[model samples]
Target chain A: MDISPDESIFLHIGPVALNATIVYTWITMAVILAISWLGTRKLTSESKMSRWQNLLEVLILGMKNQIRSISHQEPDKFLPFIGTLFLFIAVSIIMSIIPVYQPPTGSLSTTAALAICVFVAVPVYGIAKHGIIGYLKYYLKPTPFMLPFNVLGEISRTIALAVRLFGNVMSGSIIVAILLSIAPLFFPILMQALGLLTGLIQAYIFAILSVVYIASATRVHEEKEQKFEENRKGKE
Target chain B: MLINWFTVFAQIFNFLLLVFLLKHFLYGRIISAMNVREEKIASRLQEAEQKMMDAEHERDLYFQKNKENDERCAGLFASANLEAEAQKKELIENARRQVDEMKKRWNESLREERDVFLSNLRKRAEKQIYIILGKIFSDLSNTKLEQNIVETFLGKIKSLDHTERNHIKVILKESYNKAVISSTYEIPVEQQHIITAEIGDAVGETVEIRYINSQDHICGIEFKVKNYRIGWNVDDYVKFLEREVNKTLEEELAG
Candidate 1:
């Protein structure tokens, strides 16, 4: 009773000592892969959905609907990348129930990497739809002098999105681990529920914020570019 | 904070693979099969409608042809009836002509037979009369005297008038009394000699004797200035007509 099962976890990486969290991470990955395979294989449009398909469909729909509602633009293209991000974060956060389980989203590396992916994808899609010169016109809106502040604001929002998910998920993991170490059993349930709820909230926030960023970047510029291209064709 | 990049990367990659698999296998096959079945049903319905239209067109052609044939048959029937009626009329007319020709031929033969029979009868009557007249007139040849009158009263003229009506009647009456009538029933020899001189004597009047079928019969007048009347009776003519008709009928029936 003196030594806890939670502390016994350690990793032997050729000479370095690492915690047992790696095992839990590997197990979570296996769970996600198995679920994805089965869910995809069993997918039926008319039949009842599996838990994995339901989760995926819901997360994708939420992102799409929110993006469409905000910008009134087609949002289905943004869904896959956003849905992947949501699924990764959700699985990571839900694994916090294990004593050594900590979400990858807690690390600045993981959240920033995802944020950067969303960050780069938005501009890439925008430039693909609208030319470089046309995309720049979006920043010139309200005034050309407002470009510096607008660029700063956009970079800051990307940073905020990353940090916010990492903080929330990491905080929930730390709180659960500390509480479980102290009370051990009955009290851990309370921490687990809190961690689960917080994990879901963090996932939703990350997905929606990323969709908003991408939607803002790509939405209006593409419209004006279409009209411009049409006019150029007419002039020709 | 714990970071498990391996798990995070694995899960994302797995989800992407699943989406691709579903797009290729499951949804693709179901949608394609549904479209093919729908196209088959539509084509079958179209074929059935086309067949129905073709059948209706064929039926109309058949019905139209049948109507034409019926009309042609009616025309043929009417033509046949008219042809039959024409042939019947021609046959009736031919029968009438034949009957008329037969009646004409029969009348001709009847007249010829009557002439032959009447000539025989006249010869026989002549023979009988010659015998009777010879007995009565043999002694009176030199005397040649006779007179007769229908009216009992006579008037004599002071001078001779040859154009008097009474004198013609008196001459005709004297010839009749001498040759045809007498108190001793004697025929005058002079009247006989006069009758022999003329074939059908004219003595101011003519006498007609009708036979059954002959155009004329013998009529003679013998008188010094008038002639006696001589003609066959209606009863004798009727009997002669019946005898000749019966003879022709018997010959035709025998032949």
Candidate 2:
């Protein structure tokens, strides 16, 4: 059984290659965009909303709440990025129940790309909130000697975020393929259901970890003080 | 291991595009619509509150006007009552005065009517008494009473004073000694001759006498000369009695 959707190449265009993972990612994007456009096409503030619009609004509001709680910042600024991560990962995993469909999130490349986006967004938000000089100054906090460790932590956390999502989704896919080879039908369906659960958990972990990193970077001074107090408490 | 660098780059690009599209199509429009609904609700509430305040103010004004009208009505009623009371008293007093005036006029009319009745009674009584006295005297007029009256008359003539005799003599002289004798009853011829002789002696003159039977003297006798008159009859006593009775009646009425 193929472990990654990238193995099923549908086309080749010079140095860049078209694969199942790319095709499925495009489908997910198309579906998400089409639903968003259709649901909000005839919005009326004065009257009742359609059921689909109601659902969409509920999802947006719940995500905004979660973002605000986790980030302790304005949810609007990060909602699009964080909400997209959750929706894309969840849709891909749930869509794996289809007989011929393979989830793009089961590939290392897609997960790495998502983690890289989060890694990049953290510094961007930190720079926007507390100028470049103030944001860069956090690495030398408590002492200048802690800068390398802080740098290593940033790199390690980003790698961990990508690997963690990739490992969970890839393992589930691998398990389902092995089961389908062994039992052929019923166990593969069960594994797919289990994969749906794993996908949702990975999405939550990835989104929360991203929020934590962004929060730390944005409120450097406040976090530094909290960390200092914690260290003092630990010594006591 | 199947890691496609191109697919990763494409996926990142697709994710960014999705975020941009959803933000534009859904989140921004939905949040704006919610804000608009909130604004409309707030404005409607404010307008309702303003209307309530205006209604309350109008109600208070109406209440004040009603109170003033009630007070004015009460004042008017009280004034009307007082005026009505005063008019009632005036009407009563006028009626009482009219009644009193009527009573006084009635009493005066009654007194006048009583006086008129009493005067009529007294006049009738006097007339009756005169008639009765005349009848009594007429019933008592026998020949002897006539002779006695003639004798009394002759005695009275003979007992005349010197002045009276001189007056009679002057009257006789002025009359040329012509005389007439009038009687209520006819005297006998002898008595007439005697009364003529006596009267001649009293007068000291030769006088001619003409006797007449007249009844106007009411049972008395009257004599007439041309300018002097002398006679004796019951009518003089009857006139004297009537005068005395009238005087007594007048005195009693005055007392």
- Which regions of candidate 2 are displaced past 4 Å? A177-194, A220-236, B48-255
Clash-forming residue pairs, model 1: none
Instruction: Give residue B106's error in model 2 in angstroms.
Output: 9.6
Q: So what's the TM-score on candidate 2?
A: 0.62
lDDT, candidate 2, at A226: 73
Candidate 2 docking classification? acceptable
- Misplaced by over 4 Å in model 1 are A1-27, A42-71, A223-236, B1-255
Residue A191's lDDT in candidate 2: 82
Error of 1 at B25 (Å): 11
Provide the overall lDDT of each model, using Cα atoms, as 2-decimal numbers.
0.57, 0.80
Candidate 2 lDDT score at position A16: 69
Q: Quick one: best lDDT, which candidate?
A: 2
Candidate 1 lDDT over residue span B1-255, tens digit each? 233444334333444453344334423433343345457767778888888899899899999999999999999999999998999899888888888788778777766776676566555554444344444445555432222210110112112244553554465565552333222223345543443333123324442211122223221222223343333322244446557766876697558
